[model samples]
Target chain A: MNTAALHKNESTKPAPATVNQYTFTPRVDIRETENGYNLEVEMPGVDKDGIDVNLEDGVLTILGRVQPDNQDGFEKAYAEYEVGNYERQFQISEIIDEEQIEASVKNGILTLELPKHAAAKPKRIEVKVG
Target chain B: MYSLERHLFNQLSGLNSLINGLPGGTTFAAPEGRSRRDEFPRLNIWKNDNAVVLTAEVPGVDPADIDLNITSDKIGISGELPSRNRAEGEAYQRLERSSGKFQRQVDLPFRIDTEKVSAECRNGVLKVRLQRAEADKPRKIAVKAA
Candidate 1:
């Protein structure tokens, strides 16, 4: 997408552009186990329907969106922070088993499990007498 | 690691700004790197005429783990980001998220009604709402034509 043209079309300042969508990068922690690798991503305020995870061409992408929570009957006098969409991408190596990947989200954190392929697993061959 | 590189970059940028302050014949301009959100548990506090609202972004924290306290003029928030249990042979490749105890206290200018305060945790975000005390609310007076 040509985001520069979109930015130019909405060059007006002080007023937030309706098409302006910020991409927040969530913090990630990756761990490798004997069977596979685990990925933990922090994405707060995202509902179950607001998250999308896709894998294509050895690339895994995580996208999330959240609605701004505003209390009822309270007029905002000032705002010091903003909540926006989240996006992150990672490359899956050949050793990973693409067919057995799993993911779950809880308390704003997304955990992914990528198991390793059988061919990639280490093996020890026994010697036989000839 | 990315964190170490960003830390050194920030330190160099700080020194560069300090160097610019000295009387110099030449000023060096370094290209700025992409800004990173290294600070965990960012907070936002705002107030209206009737109440004050405070929100914090704290992902990976459970609702039962959070401890919140609110007085007439002060609010305190404390919580811990639990670390995930690993298997026997698990090894970390990249670790950036913070895991530990965090606490923050904010002082409000106007007194709030302790009985009316409310707090909720959803989607890893904490929102605290405090209503202004009856005597602390602004009063509107009408002037009659004399």
Candidate 2:
């Protein structure tokens, strides 16, 4: 779609609470399910080889670089947007299976599955009254 | 002498906070404390010789979470990523993952063969390849010498 119109659509959606003072940031979508949670992040110009996903200090981080094909030493005549690296971090609690958390990237989308530990699942209690 | 260099390095870091930093862009920082459900999603478009390649990034978002639609010239991608709020008493050091409505509407730069705009999702990325309409493609003319 005319990307110009896409930009307009972004403004029509509720803006994030705070705008990035300066950063080539990716938009995010979060979801919760009965078994676990998932995080989907958008990285437009990033590629699989350039992406890095890591977990440290209970924080999961996804990072990648976006560098279009080089100019063969030719300077760009006109430019409006800048392509750079992208980084996003998340703080997760005990509900996730630290050892089982999964990650995958395709078509610039990164999918992380933070599955809950077996004991973390909800159980229906049986009620018995004498 | 080496100790002096180390001291100078520390001082330089303090002085160069903004000077050496990226201009109009910062290293992405993800938010904290929201677990297994919070995700950031994305979409992309690239023009090719005979087709337009469109990609959507849906990290941690299952294929079932996405919906794709297309017409002869317009395409829309929509999905609902489940949401899970932060647990109480947990402090979020930083949060960069975003969750909510994510939609992208792309207009074809050229007329496309809508029936052939193939789409698929695998490993979290949705790819749509749109081929040009037959009428839009250039055809060669045969010349017969009399």
Q: Which predicted model would earn the best TM-score?
A: 1
* Candidate 2 per-residue lDDT over residues A70-117, each given as its tens digit: 333233322223344566555556667878977777655666777878
Off by over 4 Å in 1: A1-18, A71-80, A124-130, B1-39
> If scored against the real structure, what TM-score would every candidate get?
0.75, 0.45
TM-score of chain A of each: 0.73, 0.68
The TM-score obtained by model 1 is: 0.75
Two-chain DockQ for model 1:
0.24
* lDDT string, candidate 1, B1-146, tens digits: 33443344345434221011111101122213312223446667778788898887788888898888788998888888896676776665556678889887768768999999888888888888888999998888999999
TM-score of chain A of 2: 0.68
User: How far out, in Å, is residue B14 in model 1?
Assistant: 34
Among all windows of 10 consecutive residues in model 2 chain A, the one with the lowest summed lDDT is A1-10
What CAPRI class is candidate 1? acceptable
